[model samples]
Target chain A: MNLKELYQEIILEHGKNPRNLRKTEDFNKDAKGNNPLCGDNVHVYLKLNGQKIVEDISFEGSGCAISMASASIMTDLIKGKNEHEAKEIVEDFLGMIKENPELMSENLDEDEKTKLMSLSGVKQYPMRVKCATLSWHTLISAFDENKEEVKTEN
Target chain B: MNINQIKKEFPIFDEKIQNNDLVYLDSANSSQKPKVVVDRINEFYTKQFSNVGRSVHYLAVAATNLYENTRTSVQKYINAKDKNEIVFTKGATEALNLVANTLGQSYLQEGDEVLITELEHHSNYVPWHFLRKSKNIKINFAEINEEGEITLEEIEKKITPKTRLISITHLSNVTGAILPVKEITQLAHSKGIIVVVDGCQGAPHLKLDMQELDCDFYAISCHKMYGPTGLGVLYGKKKWLEELPPYQGGGGMINEVKKDRISYGELPNKYEAGTMATAQVIAFDQSIKFLESIGIENVMKHEADLVEYGQELLQKNNSVKLIGNPKNKGGVLSFVIEGVHPHDIATILDEDGVAIRAGHHCCQILHDKLNIPASARASVGIYNTKEDLDQLNESINNCKKIFNL
Candidate 1:
């Protein structure tokens, strides 16, 4: 119920100047996602090595503080993880954001888990859950080489 | 009219939204219902519910008469020439689709152009776009000026020899631009072009006179007019309604149904196919009565004053930018904060129990032209006051403060 829970300091900071907020040149994987309700859109780009380890990840989009910060933190932490570990972390994050009290992925370190937990505030606002999860869904789409644009409503 | 007394007629203000008074500024999207309108729906369902125009039984006759009474009320309210000119539709979107579909079937031809404005909502553009795919008609857009107003000159410029129709909004939902519809209609008529006015925003705020405007077809959204959802009125010219083909083929709209051949019914019945929104159509009479209680002149004045006050408040705030500067505007006040997104603005404002719409307001072309993804909007209705605008300004200040702007 508190506005403070939704718009924390770290969110405002990262939303103001998001990390890796650019197009990754020579990117092997990319996908677009948008929340048609509010015109929020994210284009997530990833460069994966031969072993399917993520070497770099970046995003380009405009949205609310929750979305920008969520995308910022996601691209920051997803840089070094392989495809399987990253997908597990995404599943863990989605689970934590839905009903789980804590993130359950061992692939994430204590510090990485702490950063992702800040987005748990979106769970209280059901309408805002899409803003937080848009890029993560787009990341999955990118890995699968799905050409369809990610829609939160779908 | 006393605003506080008039506000009390709506029971929603009595309820608390998150322990705060509901400051509703989303009337452009849909207005809150008055108690009489709500009670009328309850009364109809409880006592007078029946399928209209079919059975000769007591309840059916009474229900049909009540349904017909709303049609008369709408005819008088909008000052239409004939009551049959007003066809009940599901919503303004459906009304528009009916016009486009029926007109496409009968009047328009392949390669004919239908001129519209960039200020149109998706409802106005998308339906016509369907014709483009099917009939191969080209859709031309009358560009908005720097102030966002669609001038008569601009419409005149867009009308080529092949232009057969011109569909425009009476008022832009986002920019608050009131198009020069009457003049444009006159010009289009002279050029042998049909004019359809998307009057969704116009019917509730502006004066509705089909005789005066003289547009061929005008769409009205009842829910935006403080009436129930699932009901709208399509005010078409008698000639157009008669000449155009039926939008949908179903029970009541048919004059005769044989195995091989069939004939459609006359005027309004031809359009009112299938079982209609009986309860909503009946209850919308109360909405008309409610609006009549407070005159349209009074409604316009009060809303204009609120928009002016809100505009000044937002303009004075640092880093807050108003979207359009139309000289003649509506109650809509859309703006963007330098560092804050509209969704962020809406969420922060809601914390103070101030409700507003954030998005393109369903005008993506305008937003794409404005080069912003979305903007926050605060639109006023009859229940809204200067105090509500003050609250909106204060909430914007709080949102800015939170964003460290």
Candidate 2:
């Protein structure tokens, strides 16, 4: 209910001054995603060194604090992980948003779960779920190297 | 005028939103349906659901009678000279597009010009925009004044010998500025130019007498006037409707299909291509009756009072910037507050169980003209009360304070 606390200093800092907020020109994989309903756009870049992702992600976009912060944290979480682990993390994050807390708690610890709980607040506002998960969905779309186009309407 | 009595007619007013009474100020987007309209629709499906004008059965005859009864009701509602002149369309958007595609193709040529105002909605603007592009015709916009009012002088400047048609909104969706349609139509007619009036907003609030205004065509949406969605009325002059070709080619629109050639149906049916929304059309009669019972003049007066009250309340707050002219405005009040986006304002208002519209309002051209990305609008309807306006003002003030504007 406290939107100010929900968009805390950490979230605001990540939103205003996000880390890894750059387009990778020489990257092997990239995908552009947009929440057309709210005019949010994210360009995700992935650097895959064989099966192991040397640097899985970064993104540049304009959106609300939740979307930007979620993108920022998601990039940090999957940076040095393998493609399978990254996919699992993505699925787990999506399950959390879709309100499968058990699935979310299975993957993340208590402190990390509290941080992800900020996104759970978006469930109260059904209209804003897309704003919170736009970048995460974009990251999921980027996992497929051969499939260039991925558009989901949730 | 009797708030409690009028409130009883609408079932949604009785429903609570977030433990509070719903103050629906988004009527300009879509008005809430009255029980009469709802009951009529329910009755149609429950008793007499059948395809109209197709069979010799009793149900078909009854359905056909009800469907044509709506056309007559629309004719009387708008004061059209002939009932047959009115054609049922999906909505005003489709109605406007039908004119642009059918009449624009027949009348407009490569060097011809179409004069439109800057305040037109996307439905009114884009159809002509597409026509201009496809036919290589010129599309010119008349300038809007500082108060967002389009003047006769500005329209006169835009019109030329090459101007084949002049189209404009009867009342601006954003500004609520009532254009002088009579003068505009007379001027267009003087120049041998046809006129098309987008009456989607105007038809809902005002008594439209097509004989008096004498425009070549006028388009209206039923949903905006408390009627069901997917049913609209397009009132065209008989000569113009006859001259313009049918917009879409389909089954019911044709009278005879030969091996190599086909003959189209008569006036109204020629334009009506596919299976119409029969229940909605029947329900449209009840909406028209509902408006007729209360009377449009009284409704307009009530709405004007609300608009004036809203203007006074909104202007008292320094942070809130009213968008349109204060004087001679319709029921719509579009505004923007400092330091808060219209989208954020809408979200906060929604939390308080107050619904208002935010965005371009399907008038991207007007937004671009005003040099604003978006605006928030609260439009009045028959069901709305002064308390609703007060709640809206209070919520907007709350939004300003919350955003520290």
Candidate 3:
């Protein structure tokens, strides 16, 4: 309900200069996601090493401040985690965005949790919930190696 | 005309939205209904509700009279030659689909071309696309000029020898460029091609005269004309409507329901199959009365002033780029701000209760041609005023500040 809370300083900064906003050099898995409502789109690239660790995570897309900031912080926090731990973080973030009060993932540190929680303001704006979760859903599709494109209609 | 007094007739402005005053400017999507129209819908449902054109009972006859009255009013308002030429549909989408579906069934042959424009909404284009798949009809698009207008020259150039029909939008929903429908129709008729117009945006703003324009079919969205939803009117020439096959086959649209052979009913009913939106059709009569009270010329002038004022304000603002600098424009004001997405702009504006639509505005083809993902649009109606545009510009400044632009 509050615009100030929705467009926080950190979100504005991260949205302006999104981190890891590039395609992975040797991406093994990639998936495209589109928010057909606003025409926002994202393509997530994943580079998993031999030990099932996410050696690199990057994304390329154009969207609103909330969506760009969500993807930037997601890539920054999920870069070093293994595939299993990364999937857990994605579930935790998705649940928190929907109804959960806070993220409940042991894999994420306090700082990482706080960074992701800034996007929770979108929960109040139900029409915008898809913007915050499009990239995360695309990341999951990339992990599963799903060939179909991810489409968010919420 | 006193725009403020006209705004008071709409009851939604009396209430606050999210604790902020409602500055509705999304009329291109759907307009706010006046109190008279809403009250008529309630009165019809509460007291005189009955299925029309079915029974000879008291309420049935009265309800049927009311529904037919709307057809008469619409026929007179649009200057159609006959009352039977006006057929109601679910929406303009369905109306246009009816034209395409029937024409594809009876008229268009394989490899025949139907020319459309880049400024068309999906409703206008997608129907012809069906003909492409089913009947192998070719669809050609007339490109827009730099001002975002589908000029008569473009239409003339796009027409080939095999072009059987040319369907286009009366006004671009995203660019607000009002096409020269009359001239285009004349040019197409000269070449023996039929013309269909998607007037969803135009019906609410421009002066409509079916005889003057002389197009084959014109589709109108009643909700955008300050009427109820689930209602649209397709104004077709009597010759075409009689020649084309029935779109839907069901109750009321039939003459004799036999096992082997079934004959369709008369002109209007032939297109309207099954139980129609009777309540909406009745309430739409009041909508035409509301517009008549104000006069279309006055309404046109007032909205023209608002668009001019809003355009000048947005043009002066830094970092704001207005789309489509067409000399002849309608009530739409589509623009984009650099370093900010349209969804972000719309959200920030909604905080101030400045209602505007953000997205491709259902014109993705136009967006792709313009080379942008999406743009924000603030369209005006009879109820909006200069003060609302002022509030909109102020909200844009606030959004810019929030983004530290």
**Location of the lowest summed lDDT over 10 successive residues in candidate 3 chain B:** B359-368
After best superposition, candidate 1 residue A72: deviation in angstroms?
0.7
Find the 10 residues in a row with the least total lDDT in model 2 chain B.
Answer: B396-405
Candidate 2: segments with Cα more than 4 A from true spot: A1-35, A39-92, A102-116, A135-152, B400-405
Better of 1 and 2 by lDDT: 1
lDDT of 1 by residue, B242-329 (tens): 9889999999999999999999998799999999999999999999999998999999998988888888998998989998999999
Error of 1 at B337 (Å): 0.2
* Cα lDDT for residue B201, candidate 1: 97
I-RMSD for candidate 2? 3.6
- The regions of model 1 sitting more than 4 angstroms off are none
Q: How close to the true structure is residue B170 of candidate 2, measured as C-alpha lDDT?
A: 93
Clashing pairs in 2: none
Q: DockQ of every model listed?
A: 0.89, 0.18, 0.88
True contacts kept of each: 0.86, 0.00, 0.90
Give the lDDT of residue B98 in candidate 1. 97
What are the RMSD figures for all models against the true structure? 0.8, 3.7, 0.8
lDDT of 1: 0.94
